[model samples]
Target chain A: MGRFHRHTDGTVHEHEHPDVRHDVGDHTGYRESGTVRVEVLENLLAENDRVAAANRLDLERAGVRCVNLMSSPGAGKTTLLRRTITALSGTLQLGVLEGDIATSLDADELASLGAPVSLVNTSAGFGGECHLDAVMVRSGLGRLALSDLDLLVVENVGNLVCPAEFDVGEDARAMVYAVTEGEEKPLKYPVMFRAADVIVVNKVDLLPHLDFRMDRFLGHLRDVNPHARVIHASARTGEGVDEWCAWLLHVHGTPTQRG
Target chain B: MCQAIVDTVTAHASGRQVRRVTVRIGHLRQVVPDSLSFAWEVLTEGTELAGSELVVEHVPAVVECAACGERTTLDWPVLVCAACGAVDVRLVSGEEFQIASMDVAEEVP
Candidate 1:
């Protein structure tokens, strides 16, 4: 059989293939003969995963359990981390890797908590990356002495989408979901909601002032992730901070990679 | 994701002009094919893959129900099993994001 030239309309013809490009067409089954198909068969996230595994091993060797905290903007991730730092101070050696797009405001707030904090401003050199990948976390990891800390909380950039896509060598992933964000978020952004090991429903104190329904939110969340542990909390009023802190303590003590 | 594809293709192509790069993206990955192709073009402009094509193979989200013993492919992002509508289903597939293969121009003797 001669080499076939495929068209954008899903038609193929046996003829001499031209150098005409089809960048704007739907790339369904376009194939040619002069080109040799090389089977790479590699996961695009393989590079990120390899770095994440190395970061995990490094943290494990240091006897530190890391948690990746993610959420949408204004979901109170920083507030919860601040409260958690205050609640767990002196009891647990806490270290924070604060991720933000352009500002040090979050890092500034965490610095007063008396724990070692490493701020990873994505805008500095990362071309304003929306989420912190393993490479970014590794760059931040160097600033913190892992051996000196019992827990490392990576405050992923406040993005429910891209943050969930990248793994930064964390033992567990916690998502701070505010009640005001709407019940349909789980269904709308299932990737982020499903990736969470624990979903902290923040701003529950304002539940009375809003039209948010806990039952509906839980129902939707269950549809996406039935196994994620849900915790009702308010970072502003310090409610449920103890429960959140206790969960962190428990996760820190547990060996994440025993199997 | 586009950046990852370019890097992978570049590494595998190894100085050869890339004719086409094939990638398999699961529905759960939430990648829009058009946006990916646009990004690919933007990233490949002026590079060896300038006029190269990006072939996208979309993988649907499939789940196996634990209670009903059924495997269903979902059209939406919801993870519920379509057979028995059970939420206690494990993901069978749909988290894939990989470069399957690439076509490079054959060397002329």
Candidate 2:
């Protein structure tokens, strides 16, 4: 017969073989055995989720609605952010947290527009993680004036795969998919598409130059994320910026009409 | 991600030599198992977990319709209900990322 012991630390040690020692040595009353089954049913991302939950509570307490924006590289996320900041500067107080593997070039650009921005260079720590987890977002939050801001936007490191897995405690998750990237992106990177609450099809101005089909793209997006609000935009010509800004205002529960 | 795994293994299986480690990953997690395995090999080169086998179990995503209560094991990216065609569906499983158990070679005293 095998012996089973429960430790105060919540670890269960089970000795399945007769040759295994119930009490060989050590203060824990369990010794080196033939094969010990240590049941550790713990999530690997539990720590991250805990930190994310705290971040959510912190943002909620400050009455700041946070949005996490994720997309592939060269998806016009920074351009969209710049336009949104310029459009909503007078209507709502906005702050941005920009995440990058290296360089604060995007942050500097946003700051030039007179927007409050914080830069999180992941290359500085965690070995340049491709995704911005909750801990990194919390570090960025420390540098921003949360009390003075009504909306906080976190532009996640430009990657479709890893960023979708980590939740940074944002009230809404949005993604930008430029039409130049092709219509097959929604299916190719389904996780990011599925996780998004809103998806913006940027670079509509280039639609005439490219073979991107609107119906096929929307069909793929709807198949993966039926509830995601899809907005067609052209950051270069300021097309769809009004509707996008209106959606943002609506999400923030503020009056959509400008004074 | 590799560093997190090393820390977790060191914390739980301290004294013993980890021969193999099993992890259960959900489909919705977007973790590439092959990439993870490669990362494990690179990260554990000089550590105690060197040469340890990394076993992975993938769990398929399951979504439950909020409107019709239809459950489905999703093969594709489509999250809508198969039974009711309802757009309002909640994921019930497939976000799991956990260290299920480890097979360690105990040091004979």
Candidate 3:
């Protein structure tokens, strides 16, 4: 007899195969083919894309432009977000969906800025995915008041590899690369750099103390993403914050430019 | 990732035990095939797909340029056209992550 077990989650598993004597022409007066081939041309991420479509519709209906921000750990993505929020909060409404492997520290920090913030901790479930896929972003959307905000930014989990794979219904994709991370990052993590619509080179204040070559970095970046707008900024010093804000406003189609 | 693979196998094979699965992943998808295979071995221990082979095929990234009508394969992410240097290029492929086919041991009814 075939041994079968059902888990509480409703997944069925066949534990052991049943032994039976079978002749070639025993069943239905035809020979049994023990092996079969089935063609299934279906994308594994299709389900996630379906949810992402719904998320896109929701954001569109609310007139909220969402940006998915990705980068490696300690790249100052949160700091750049804080500076962006502080620079534009006076003229534009903003909301944040902070993604992390664990802890609500980033969300808590953004919340201090008085902007509506929601936390999506992948570690709670979803196997602590290093990237924020569309399904996760859809779930995070439910926690935010989309109608109250003109723009929503999803700070993806700090990783360069997997984050670029999943699309989270974002109007734009941006990434921050800190100077301290070195210049060869563009080639090492080409997918992340290539997927980004905007690339911000952060921590320019420390460039004088480091051996980072801007030319090599830009060369690699241009080779990977020829169309991405490059911006240099120092979140700590507030340098290039206005230019970045202007670019954001321009891309968002908002007429108001920061004075 | 294993869950998705298991679901696909179960849906296609039904009561049959899966023998092997072939998946086509694109360059831009960022999935490490070795890691996926390792995870599959661990996750399918008690399932019907146990001992099944996981085969991965990588697809190259291709982009079609609107200006020059050039379709070229890109090793990296150069969105611009090589001929005319136009940035008006649309991605033709390289984002795929799909189960192309499966081999299963069919039960003789």
**Which candidate should be chosen as best, given TM-score against the real structure?**
2
DockQ of each: 0.53, 0.58, 0.52
Q: What TM-score applies to chain A of candidate 3?
A: 0.86
Model 2 spans > 4 angstroms off: A1-3, A19-33, B65-71, B80-89, B105-109
- Chain A TM-score compared with the true chain A, each model in order: 0.85, 0.92, 0.86
> What's the candidate order when arranged by decreasing DockQ?
2, 1, 3
Better of 1 and 3 by TM-score: 1
**Candidate 3 colliding pairs, count:** 0
**TM-scores, each model vs. reference:** 0.89, 0.90, 0.85
- Which portions of model 1 show Cα errors greater than 4 Å? A1-33, A254-259
Highest lDDT: which candidate? 1
What TM-score, to 2 decimals, does candidate 3 have?
Answer: 0.85
* Residue A38, candidate 1: alpha-carbon lDDT: 64
Local distance difference test scores for all models: 0.87, 0.86, 0.83
Q: Give me the displacement of residue A77 in model 3, in angstroms.
A: 1.2
Error of 2 at A215 (Å): 0.7
When 1 and 3 are scored with lDDT, the better candidate is 1
